[model samples]
Target: MQSKKIAIIGAGVMGKKHAQTIVKHPDTELVAICDPFSDAMAQEFNVPNYKDLDDLLNTMTLDGVVIANPNRFHVSTAIQCMQHGVTCLLEKPLALNTAEALTLIEAQQSLNVPILVGHHRRHNKIIQQAKEIIDAGTLGEINTFNALWSVYKPDSYFDIEWHRVAGAGVLAINLVHDLDLMRYLNGEIESVQAMTSNKNRKLEVEDSISILVRFKNGALGTLLASDAAVSPWGWDQNTEENKTSFAVSPDQDCYFISGFEGALSVPNLEYWNYPKDQSKSWSTSLMKNKVEPNKEEDVYIRQLTHFVDVMNGIAEPISSPQDAIHNIQLLECIELAAKEQRTVYLEQLQCFKKSA
Candidate 1:
């Protein structure tokens, strides 16, 4: 098969990562780059850089474009690419808010162009294995989930003005990834109750938050996140997916899920259940087993391969725009819950007004 030609938009950290992965992948070719601010990444990768999306689109015949631009430009860029009939691997937070996301959702529904939202964790072998295990009924009738994402970012990391602002807080910046994975692994969230605090950093944005969620299936979940605490109990810390950005906590587990038949811990994939021969009671000890995931592959590479499949019509997007919109709605519900000091149902959000 001929290599698929791919272009990257935005020359930031994520764009550079995608460029590197594309260059290395045997099935992909790095064609061009579009970024208004910087051409440094384009120069490093030895690709022609254009300052505008239209210029790049008109010049190059691209099979797919990786939209790794800033959060604000996500929806517009994706729409532009789809209008040109190019597939996209759009970075997450598909839009600034649920309302903005709805616009993209509508464009996608009308255009019928494939867009793979970059909820990249879904490509991790560990997560894939966990999904299979759960789907196989290994953990029968999931009842609850407990997840943690607490890590103390260095004080200097917040020196950037935006880091201290409302839109760049831990909930939006960090916890969104965890929440996406929760919804991916568990199920759709029905409602949420949440609390946020910024006392640790005294910034305009919250540094810590606690959320309670009720899944549509009646399974409950709790997520505790803090960017101001010193802890090694987050997906980034436990998984080596982004070691350059986060220190690894080799022996820790970040998610604990339980059900009537068994309980499971994430990353480590430890399984706990009573042996069939033994009596199902508190008096008997539960058997412990390790569920091994497939050999590790770089998640970004996996995501790109999947994007290629999506572009070729061989596979549907694992994280479609419609699916990602729910994640945005979930975040909005949490924000409303925290702001109003009350439980917020996912259906209450205005983004759901049309669908509901």
Candidate 2:
């Protein structure tokens, strides 16, 4: 079987993960990894590596590229890869801002190539089952949803240069995932009222953010994210008392969703379809399929595999550059609402208005 050649930009933690995925996947070969900090990640993955995007592009014959660089570098790297006719699976938030993300999207449309965004949460088995339940109308009308995402960023994390960027902190890096998930499950966000602060962390970007969002379908979604907790991870009943940190237990990482008819939780993507009085409330369940808990394989592998598949004409790309643009537009709304202490209307995302 012929394998597709792939290049991963940014030899950061995430970049190395994508490289490992490419090397392991049966359908792809990791041609090279590019990053200015290649030395920092030199031994992280076994692959042909480089220190610059241009070097990798010039040196290798590649079918796709993975943009796992800093948030600010996403647009330029994606544009470069796509302009060369290479499919890209870009890391989330799309870009540092909506305008840049939209520009890339327009360019992507002209190129007519698949550009998939790295929103791995969208591929979680539990989340997939929840979406199926919602579409099946087993949940009835979705009235309310709450997404809580919080973690303590350690002092070491602050040492990174990009971590200090104005728009690269928790809001764009962390909450963007939940925000995208909300849109994935419920629908478009129509408006948002938000609040954010950096009271605890002495950083350029806000460490904590909370937003009240109204979905177009009238579903109320409340999303929260923070990196200000004393311990990054919360107290666990099973662990020793001293085990208080940002390290999340696999069991605890699960999310849940509730509706008029039933509720669905991680590990148990089950649904109680019947009402209180109707035939004992029918219950259907799906057991969690535990794949190897390797971060590289679970998230980055599926992401790269999806990208290679699209490039090879095996599967259609699921997340388009337009999706990334829309997600970034939503992130922009959240940022503005939080900064100004006002409700940001979805229509106000004209900053990402399609260019003529």
lDDT of 2 by residue, 167-278 (tens): 7777776676677777888878889999887888767778887789888888787766677764323222111121343344544433455666555543334444444444
Q: Write the per-residue lDDT of candidate 1 for residues 244-333, one digit (tens) a residue.
A: 989899678999999989889998998889999987788889999987755378998899889989988999999998888888888888
Model 2, position 244: C-alpha lDDT score: 44
- Give the range of the ten consecutive residues with the poorest summed lDDT in model 1: 347-356
For each candidate, what TM-score against the reference? 0.98, 0.81
Residue pairs with clashing backbones, model 2: 152-232, 232-245, 232-246, 233-245, 233-246
Best by TM-score: 1
- Model 1's alpha-carbon lDDT is 0.90
Off by over 4 Å in 1: none
**Model 2 / residue 64 / CA error / Å:** 1.2
TM-score, candidate number 1: 0.98
Q: List the residue pairs that clash in candidate 1.
A: none
